[model samples]
Target: MGVGVRVGVFLPAAGFPGMDHGEVLAAAVEAAVAAERAGFDDVWIAEHHFMSYGMCPSAVTLAGYVLGRTERVTVGTAVSVLSTCHPVALAEQAALLDRVSGGRFRLGVGRGGPWVDLEVFGTGLDRYENGFEESLDVLLAALGRERVSAEGERFRFREVAMVPRPARPMLPVVAATSAGTVRLAAARGLPMLLGMHVGDAEKAAMVEEYTAAAGDLGGPEVAHVAAGVAYVADTTREAVAVMEETLPRWLGPGLSGYRPVDGRPYVPKDPVEYAGLLCRLHPVGSPGHCADTMLTTIERTGVRHLILLVEGAGDPALTIRNIARLGAEVLPKVRASA
Candidate 1:
């Protein structure tokens, strides 16, 4: 509503049913370019390993690829699983992406999900909080051109200078948080990228707590508080159909590894049932309906940035068209009201 209510579209590089990996990756690059041309402000990619649902195991790498193709739209990892990758390497890749994108790169970091199968990669989940924090410290220090000497519980670094610092002295860092990670982000003075599935009540509380805590830390006011929600179609009925058809196959039990939330159930047996549940949290309807829902949510939550996960929609073409329509029709009205 603040005129800069950024509306972004998510590109799920791997999750589409029967989508060839190579073609899906290509579509992702194309989607970034299309989103930019369609007047979106930012494009986000996710990080998940060994999962058919999300092919981008390394968002930094995919971001680099997007950088080569798009010129104006900002590119970012919806999250880079910081607990699994070395901070120095992560910093280097981010710096390189910033360079390629000409300073249009933002960063989102988080503790890797439990379902990510870190054990197979010889990584332990114990001390994840420590590792996530230290990695952020190291990344920030490296970006600021300072030699880092970190000897924490999970990792040890000895006064090593990382080269090729980001073009921007302090790259925009958004810490991905839910109920569990919100306090951590506030403690570290980082902006937050709320996850895709939080309910309305929880989402509002998160924004309030984050803003208050960030103020107390004397940190820069949150640059953006972005929430991810699935956007399905041009009409409520059409949207319902898409969600009904796709949600079950994708959320089936065999794919439990894709979602790491504890005790969260997979998709419901009936599409209408799932649609009803998701609609409470996601914006899924016609352009006008979506606009109204989004505006109401933003007004209530004070969330400045909105990232719509159109990737789950059955048809990519429909998703792209809806995004363009949202940009042209929905955002302007919302901004006027704000």
Candidate 2:
């Protein structure tokens, strides 16, 4: 590994103030293009339903689109909601994407949010846990074999085969965060994706758990890829200023009652505490500061892949510029430190 760490960009497929739905999607594409040109490793698209919070209800579709538009840049779903689709269809589409992209596709799956997704998908929160397990079984089976069957609690399929099989022998599956989901990923020898909200201590504990769970029989030890907001500016003050203005929109009431991965009871925080925690845990500062924060995280924990949440960092121009600065000013220093 040249740097022992890889940096990816988390494209915002969600709402933005003054930006229309079409523009947000287009901006995400532009951001991916810029990130690739800026030497970023991969692009992960998000999935949401029935809310402006995240406009991309189909991360797989967006992944396919991005794959078609870019060369050499790996495209993945930050998560494609398993609860929302027929697993066989999802596997076929994902495989086709991989085939077309010449094996540069990754599949990241998550049990989706509880609000509009649950309401629209007609899945009560009660079923989410079991549904996720069942859906995952179907997805994994479909991806690995020509024909598969699953008599899962919520889903049952017989002799289903994914057409246009994946070009590569194996496509990487990255599981997003949840309390017990890390172990779930490890048991299958798959990697896990973490989010910004997880504090440093929790990340260390999670990584330890994954390492222990993946002992001995490892094909690859857990690929712990974490994501957080990042923007590079001439000064920390400028970066913080931009974040303060745009964060309210990104963290708006749409996420109210959102249950954290640790299963902690949701508690409203004072603005000061929130802002303080944001700076303490995330990279929202000058290019040098950004490099320092990333290096610190890599040192503290074994996280090697970071998906910089740059979609809402600023306007389209600023977001693009942040990618360039991170690639030029920050990446070298951070990688060199390795």
Candidate 3:
């Protein structure tokens, strides 16, 4: 395990059964503020469009908002859906936030699902299926150099100077859920953001693949981030109970809302079963158990930075409390052992 295990919060801005978008977003901001106060290292915002699962449409915009609200913690998108966004425009926004936030902003981009977002954003289904690499290339170019142009199969443009250059050259963290994405990120010498749904073994496998693929680049060590659910209570039972009571109600509707643009047969996970799996996979227990679980994950995945999804309780106040406990109670133990 690494000498220091960095902890951060994942504010999904999840819209539970009865909550409105305003309330969801408010809870997210409150959680971010609470995580910072609790002494966590970062706050990562999740982006989802036109869904009750996650209400935030523009993660970069929300990241800017979170950055303005906190002074110390790093703020980033759990992922900004790259397939649905114009790479140059998103890079420009990332650079602006990086400049204003004093390099506290991290742009985490992913090839989002085959959803209606492509149609709504006017990027189309082909971009989601085949154009992500080109988009990523454009994004990297726009961020790496003062002037950029693209003459790719999907995008063609004349050169334009990057205005208001970032505090440093932007190196966005690419979200990797599959081999192709992992290889793409590794090829670019970019760090990866691994998803929460997988087990320790699976995450470790992804890390191994990334490490092998990234071996030849020989740059500074990449700080890969792992996302997981988090909850804390005096007893493991109490923590698990809370997650069981609330997570399914939130997950059921949210997971079912994704309309696959390719007309592929899509079967959403059974929310109750999924919630149980998350409880088993994540740190949903007493502080001691949570700390131990984190340590084990770190040892297995070789990933030192963790971004925990703290909204599993599906209540604003409880989510904030979870963040507080994670930072104040769980983080100390993890760090001490690390």
lDDT of each: 0.69, 0.75, 0.90
Ranking by TM-score: 3, 2, 1
Model 3: lDDT of residue 323: 84
Backbone-clash count (model 2): 0
If scored against the real structure, what TM-score would every candidate get?
A: 0.88, 0.90, 0.97
Winner by lDDT:
3
Residue 126 of model 2, lDDT score: 46
What is the Cα-based TM-score of model 1? 0.88
lDDT tens digits by residue: candidate 3, 101-181: 999998999999999788777889999889999999999999999899988999999999998778797788899999999
The list of candidate 2 runs beyond 4 A from truth reads 1-3, 123-126, 217-220, 256-276
- Model 1 regions lying over 4 Å from their true place: 127-130, 171-180, 218-220, 230-234, 258-275
Worst 10 residues of 3 by lDDT: 214-223
- Rank the candidate models, highest lDDT first: 3, 2, 1
Instruction: Tell me which residue pairs clash in candidate 1.
Output: none
Error of 2 at 28 (Å): 0.8
